[model samples]
Target: MERVEPMTLFGYEKLQAEVKNLKEVKRPRVVKDIEEALEHGDLKENAEYHAAKENQRIIDSRLAELATFLGCAKIVDPSELDHVKVSFGSTIIMTDVKTDEVFSYTIVGGSESNPDKGLISFGSPLAKQLLGKEEGDEVVIALPNSKKTFEIDEVKYQEIVFECD
Candidate 1:
């Protein structure tokens, strides 16, 4: 069975835009470059042709990846889910037990996760640990270096907003 990934509307639209841009703008330009390179000289030792072919390969690979991601995407509206417990699209406010540090995390799709921005994928280790947990529950997350405990202070379902840089 194909795995279905939960994605917010914002995330879905973002990916769609990227795919469209690549298909319409970038891919055509690369194809033209390859065409121009092919006309330059002998195919045996043409550096420009080889480089263009490599670039086309990279673009095709990325397009394939995006296609797969879009095919299995399940758009989920965060506002529709229950906020009483931690789950996909839930925003959690937590406190680190050891250092008393506060952190806020929003569970998002793999394509849109930004750890620095507190947007974590639902499949992430931290989000996995927090799933099914309720507010006031303590969760232990196994980091790469060590395990840290956190108290789930809030499980909220707010509108998921995507910001452009």
Candidate 2:
């Protein structure tokens, strides 16, 4: 089955930018490096040539991966969606019932998710349980090691910031 990738506009644009950079900047530089290395002599012992070829292979691979991601991308803009109920792109604020610790997370695409930055992928365990939950609802999530319960404090739409400030 073909996987449908649900990505925010930011994520999509980021992928596009990476592709552009690889093609326009990185690819040409590697090509030039390889050409220059070719003049240095025998291919059997040319480390520079080998290194440049390896770099070219890596760049090409990344470009192909980016192409697949872009091809399957379904750009989603949270600003246009309703925030009354939990769903993709919703920034959820919750309090851990057991520890009484509060945490906030924004549900995003797999490519956009950075748990350290509070961006959780919609496919994750926590996001799956939070999908249709509303404010004031209690949620129980099954983690790999243990189970944790949380009370939903708020659900709102905020522009996703993929990078840390």
lDDT per residue as tens, model 2, 20-83: 8899999999999999999999999999999999999999999988888888888988899999
Cα distance off (Å), candidate 1, residue 40: 1.2
Where does model 2 exceed 4 Å of error? 162-165
Write down the lDDT of every candidate, Cα atoms only.
Answer: 0.90, 0.91
TM-scores for every predicted model: 0.94, 0.91
Worst 10 residues of 1 by lDDT: 156-165
Model 1, CA-based lDDT: 0.90
Q: Give the TM-score of candidate 2.
A: 0.91
**lDDT measured at residue 140 in model 1 versus the true structure, 0 to 100:** 88
List pairs with backbone clashes in candidate 2.
none
User: Which digits, one per residue and each the tens of the lDDT, describe model 1 over residues 26-134?
Assistant: 8898899999998997988999888888988998898899999999999998888898999888999999998999999999899999998899999988888899999
Summing lDDT over every window of 10 consecutive residues in candidate 2, give the lowest-scoring window: 156-165
